[model samples]
Target: MTTKVLICLYENEVCPRFDLTREVLIAVIDRDAAVLKEKEVVLPQASLEMLCQMILTEGIQVVICGGIEEEYYQYLKWKNVKVLDSVIGDCKLVLQRLVQGRLKSGDILVE
Candidate 1:
């Protein structure tokens, strides 16, 4: 099964807060965990509602972000989007771990 993952970004790094993020990296990975496609999305503004809408509309199965509020976190989970929050690292590194099934919530990859 292929999975679509979204990563909130800020200047090549994971955004510090999900609600305040304006840019995101989206990737499509196949069952074998190979990334088939990837792109960056720049939102007009930072809004959690918009983010949620994007996730639902784009069929995102997983969301990797940093410092999400409890409400939004639960909301995403309720929507069936796996939320990996509080991840600190380069976006590339985060995506690598995600594809390897090693990324976890609250993971800090930066030393």
Candidate 2:
């Protein structure tokens, strides 16, 4: 089986705020922990509503992001997306940890 994980991005790191994110990195990981595919999606603009729509439309199963609003967080959860919020780090490191099954919400990987 494969899981789709979306990481809210700012340059090469996790965006500090979810609603302000304009870019996202999506990865498809398989049961063996190998990334089957990866893609970067640039939104037309930073809008919470647009982002939420993209997340659902893209079939994202997991979300890795920083500082999310309670309403949005709860909404995603209600939709069955696993949100790993409050994460701060290099996107590569975050992805590595995720593939290893160790990534978590509130993770601070930057020094």
For each candidate in the order shown, give its overall lDDT on alpha carbons. 0.94, 0.96
The regions of model 2 sitting more than 4 angstroms off are none
lDDT of 2 by residue, 1-111 (tens): 999999999999999999999999999998898999999999999999999999999999999999999999999999999999999999999999999999999999975
Clash tally for model 1: 0
Candidate that scores best on TM-score: 2
Q: How close is candidate 1 to the true structure, as a TM-score?
A: 0.96
Could you estimate the TM-score for every candidate? 0.96, 0.97
Worst 10 residues of 2 by lDDT: 102-111
Q: How far is candidate 2 from the true structure (C-alpha RMSD, Å)?
A: 0.8
